[model samples]
Target: MKGNWLLLIGAYFSAVFYSTAFCVVTLHVDPESHYLEGGKEGTLEIWLEGVQNSEEVFEFTINVSTNNEDVFEITDKVLVVGSIKSKVPYTTHKAGNALISFEQVSGHHDNADNGTIVSDVGDVYAHIYVIRSQPLNVFNIIVGWIYFTAWSMSFYPQLYENITRRSVVGLNFDFLSFNMLGYIVYSIFNVGLYWIPKVQDEYRDEHPGQLIPVKLNDVFFSLHGGLLTAITIGTCFIYERGNQSVSWICRVSISIGLTYILTLAIISSTDKFPNCTWWHFVSWISYIKLIVTVVKYCPQAYMNYSRQSTTGWSIGNVLLDLTGGICSLLQAFLIAYNSDDWPSLIANPVKFGLGILTIIFDAVFMVQHYILYADAHYSKSGRFLSGGGSKKGYKKIHDSEKGSSENSNFFRT
Candidate 1:
């Protein structure tokens, strides 16, 4: 009898270990999201994977619920799940956003729903977006790509100016300093969230049922930005930028931003700060980027104001930035309007606020280039302007600080 009892316990322990190590369940809601106009229809393919075939298994119930019933008309029912998979058809009624949740409430065979029986069955969600119209939805998607392209190309104009002119005089040093640091922090945040397994796990745990916000393009953009920004900074070293050096103000600002960013990273690694995780660290880094964006343009704008000319600055970069800002705002509004989720406009204050700020700065640069300083002539020295805007106490301002000393500079735009 003692040997029989020991043999039974050993079998149970092996089964437990096998189930834990080998059997991993994942609930897949195909497509993850659907976009439709009001009164449209869509089908969702639901499959619960990793459940081994067992003769004793009977059935399971996948309870379906929605955050907003107005958007999708879904009928929740007990799906015997013969093969652990089924199709769920849904219809849209009005313009709104909703998440349809699928959770395994119970299992007839195991009599256990908490995953110890077969595998862990967690909640899966599919998004239903019943927009006001199809055109707006298409517009929103198109605008998203447009802004992405615009922002991505914006860097090239400035890079080309520095490379072709071999001069980075009009390009503010403070702007370069802040921009390089911002991209460095941004690249770290993107890489950590997207590539690091530990950070990915923490992010999934913190925001379950939601797709990881960092995507391949985001990772590419951040890294691309860092690389380009670094190259531009290098140009500042090799180019014919006369007496143009990063100011004290820029150094102090960059030092503080980098210090804070590093502190967060260390806190995440050492776990010195309670509940501060890699997710939290990246989040703080992204926020710091927003702060950086707010100030990064200021230096360039101030420099333009002081110099009374945007001779060294590339207007192509400004125009591209303006296009990106416009498209970004348009896309945000289009999405909000189509889904009737107006409040989502402000949901991500950082992203929205950054867009607004970028537009404002672009407008300033445009005015300086196209209107305010359009008539200003670049002298041989650019070290001195014959007659222009404020000359109060602005002595550091130099004409040699301007772009190409030659009037025939092709990068005037």
Candidate 2:
């Protein structure tokens, strides 16, 4: 029985290690990156970058076919930027990298349901390697699906341990709860997006043009998986941090970030975009909170660097985060690659800029995590507290003799 119990514990932690390491890559969520504006006639501009001049970009073809009505006609297909006469109603020529724009018929902007049809415009317009519905992007989809499944499966053991222990000694409650709530809300909202009448109508209208309904998968990744993993890890972190001000700050920051992003998404779902108001101010403030989090966590990152340790950090979690970041970058490439696919009436440069930022930060975070683990001091099981609760528990472990002796006493007790 003792041996069986030991085996189970070993298996459980092993699963945890693997799951956490591959968190982002495995549980990729779709972030909403596209938005639609209703009008009698409207235009969208998609700007493509990182492409060679006069290159035969097979991905540059903008296919727009609608089963509903062929009533619409392009007013101007070619945008005369510099000397290039691209397409009209859709244009391939614009200044800077390359610009693509589309013109839609007036008074037919939205479907019967009247809900906004927004997706990650970046993913749709960009010429990144990963195509949203293309068969070629199956690897990304498969990788993401596997990641999510693994994450969900791994949750059980940690949950069991938490239940048996009753107290989450190393858990961070605030971080966990806020992210849990955020992800839950995000998941439910995504499902709601499917059932919402406006969304359905919009999808029906855009059928053949863009099959999938407006969902968050475009911007961030997978709503359900990302939220679940984030919340789970966050809960552990909050519980571990206890009631310190730092804990409270984390909770508030996460809460604000979740609230701001979710609120913007909700507003974007409506016919009219929720313009700047007090809530908008709050949203921008929340954006700052995210920056603060990165800065605040600098010390933790520094500690990991100084000690050359991925000790207290979960390699599994960091790995997941890195994978998620890569996925986001892929999404960005898709958006920025073909800028001419969208209409000019509803394009926002700020959104694109922010998308760029997300990719950059994600890359940095992932590299840092890898660096920490590559160090000589990197341990398989992160720096977690022993169950004995001794005063020396917080002391860093470096010697095998001290570790073995402590382990013997711990098992003996």
Per-residue alpha-carbon lDDT of candidate 1 for residues 1-413, written as tens digits (9 for 90 to 100): 99999999999999998875566656576778778888977887766566654322323444444434566777675353534556667788878877766545544445444432334345466777788999877778788888888888888888887777666767887888888888888888899888999888788787776667888888988888888888877777666676566778877887888788788778789976658988888877777788889889988898888777787788998898899899889888888888888888998887888889889999989988887777555455433343245433323344455443344232222
> How many clashing pairs in candidate 2?
78
lDDT of 2 at 223: 59
TM-score of each: 0.84, 0.38
Candidate closest to the true structure, highest lDDT:
1
Regions of model 2 farther than 4 Å from truth: 1-178, 181-185, 198-223, 226-246, 251-309, 331-413
Evaluate all candidate structures by whole-model CA lDDT and list the values in order: 0.73, 0.38
lDDT of 2 by residue, 1-413 (tens): 99999999999999886553332211011121222211223244433222222221212233333212332333432222211223323222221122222331111112222211122322342111111233324444565555445444433444444434432333333434444444454444455445456544444344422334334442233354555556455444323222222344555666676676667666654637435332233334434433543343344454444443433344454444445445544544543332323332125555445545544544544555454244333223322322211322233544431122122221121
